[model samples]
Target: MDELFKGIADPLRREVLELLRKAPLNINQINDHFGHISRQAVSKHLQLLEDTGWIRIYQAGRERYGYLSKSAFYAFKDWVDAYLQWGAHSIDNDHGVFLDDTAYKKGMPLTQPVMLQALLSKDKTFDGVFYTAVKTTGIFCKPSCSANPRPDNVIFYDNKDDALKNGYRACKRCKP
Candidate 1:
């Protein structure tokens, strides 16, 4: 997790990931996108990405192409979801803690506690950021759902696809 976080810590690295999303590219093709940076610098970024398992580098004839690894991102998501789950369980969701828009949207939290708080308070700002999965009910809800769930029974997922894959149906109330 630390390696993955460190790998994506730089804006340029993140952009490389974004670029790779469109299509796989060799070092030269990737370096061409950033005119100001040296190819060596780009190589370093590619190396970092490769080292962190974010990308798979392979030789197609003489050219080496880098492709994004979906599993790496899934792992990252799982880690964040776990963090949110821990936060939701560790903190009191009713005190209005981490419920404020600034707290959840600042690119930091603000996930589990904020997610649970959003679920409890029906905060619309976090609707798509994460989904609330109720273990006992076997249903998932958008953060803005009108239904009130016990925080202890909730597991947070960053994507609705995950909730669906996990065999949890979307709630009738939220239609998430």
Candidate 2:
């Protein structure tokens, strides 16, 4: 997903992820690792990581702790593995795979364009008809959720189980 790619694409955020991979760290502790960068900058990186599902932050009284999300890491790994497999087996100069309408439409209730439209409008009419998963947030919501996910970061599933199987969490707000 675009958000997963964007999350690890940043050098600084990657460094932070490397740190969290070793063990959970509190806010001040994570900040200490980057002495050259202001604490605010470090905090912003942590926020991005959390938003993109690379990390999860939880409050413990006064101390907030951060930890890597293994599901997120595994999702990224699976994506890379698929890409590597595709590249390795490709014929000379071969690239791209295009699916025709029948292949693309075989099992969907609503077309993608309509799904995007329904999602943007928060149309309750489509609730339970399909779910929209926001890649950046790693959460899926019903069409009625009060969310305006960017079209590029959205993935649609006829059922929530597919979204969960692909490593997305149900949105607490919508309980989808």
- Among the numbered candidates, top TM-score falls to 1
Question: Worst lDDT window (10 residues) for model 1?
Answer: 89-98
Best by lDDT: 1
lDDT computed for candidate 1: 0.82
RMSD of 2: 18.7
Residues 1-176, candidate 1: write the lDDT tens digits: 89999989999999999999999988888999999999899999999999998999999999999999999999999987765654463254443433443454446645566676677766666778788899999999998787877889999998999999999998998898
Error of 1 at 161 (Å): 48
TM-score, prediction 2: 0.49
Clashing pairs in 1: 84-112
